[model samples]
Target: MELSWSTFLLEILNFFVLVWVLKRFLYRPIQSVIARRQQDIDARLAEASAKEAQARRLQDDYEDRLAQWRSEREQSRQALEQELRGEKARREKLLAEDLEQQRARSVAVDSRRQGEQRRQLELQAMEQGSRFAAKLLEQGAGPETEARLLSVFLESLAEMPEARRLQLCAQLRDTPKEAQLQVASAYPLDGGMRNKIEQALTACLGRPVACRFTEQPELIAGVQVSMGAWVMGVNVRDELQGFAHLAPDSVGG
Candidate 1:
């Protein structure tokens, strides 16, 4: 409570000394520690920023790889579809060609079979017609037809060529005068017809000739003159045989 100059001055001096000690020993060291802690915090923040940028770059690369894979998968799927379509079209075309070939072959075979059947029918008809004609002629043969055939035969002998008559005369000249000239017919010849035939033979040969008459039912309404190897005839049997030979033959289809 007493205001003394000396004591006051002493108190002021102690206060100044305490301030210098705190500045030198506590304040300066505390400020140094705070600066070091601030530097450590700044370095950790820079490292965190760099790591974040690297993570972003990695994510972008992964996304690009995924997009490229999807594009490649789409391309492969489209190519497979196109190949399947082409293969299907080729198989269908081959099937169509094979079917057409089979149809054409079937048609050709059917046509050939039809033609063979028609030919067989025609041959059968021809054979039947020949047999019918032969039966009809056989039933119609009689003495009237035989007489007409004999008359035709006599006329044919009268119309014989001079050279043919000479050949016949030469052939008969080697035979004996007493050799019989055989005259065959389908029916019995009357005496007048026989005498006429004998006279004609005598006139044709330029010599007298003996005669012999015979009935040959197999002649079928015609005359056959025979002497040794020489023979001539015109008969219904010969005509029917020629008609039968005209029929066509059957062949393999």
Candidate 2:
């Protein structure tokens, strides 16, 4: 409680000395340590922020690449489906074409078979008709028929073309031996008929002609005449054979 100036002044002086000592050694060193720790904290925080930004950029890039991969996969699927459809359509078209060609071939083969059958039928009819006629002609032969055929033959020879008559005359004259004139009939001839034939031959040859007569029943109903290499006949058998040999097309021709 006693106010003493000296004591107070001395106390004030001690207080100033304590403050200078704390500022010079303890306070200055603690402030330097705190400033260095603060600088280290700020540098660590800046580094953490930069690493966080890099991680976000990496995540965004990964998302974009994933999206692109999904889009490409879908496009590939669509293209593959379209290609498969096109291939199926093309194969179907080819199959259809092949089937049509087979149908056409079948029709052509059927037509050909029908034509062959028709031709066979025509040939059969012609053969049957030929056989029937041959039998009918065989039943109708006689001396009377032979006489008529011989007379017709003589008439035809008399009315022969001038050129053909001349050719026969030349052939007969050029023979190395005497042109042998052989005359025959299916039926035997009497004296009167033989004289008539001889006169006709002599008139046709324009010269005197010698004759050799014979009977030939195979002639079926006719006369026969030969001189050297030349032979003439008017017979049912020969005419029937020529008719049998003719085909349907050749009959009209």
**Could you report the Cα RMSD, in angstroms, for every candidate shown?**
10.7, 7.3
Q: lDDT tens string, model 2, 196-240? A: 888887888788887899888777788888875787768776776
TM-score of each: 0.45, 0.51
Q: Residue by residue across 1-253, what tens digits does model 1's lDDT show? A: 7899998999999899899999999999998998888888888888888888888898888889889989999999999999999989988888988898888889888888886777777767766876787677678888888878778867767887899889989998898999988878878889998987888778877889888899888767777777898765556666666656655543332
The TM-score leader among the candidates is 2
Off by over 4 Å in 2: 4-31, 129-253
The weakest ten consecutive residues by lDDT in model 2 span 244-253
The lDDT of model 1 is 0.80
What local distance difference test score does each model get?
0.80, 0.81
Number of the top candidate by lDDT? 2
Error of 2 at 157 (Å): 14
User: Least lDDT summed over 10 consecutive residues: which range in candidate 1?
Assistant: 244-253
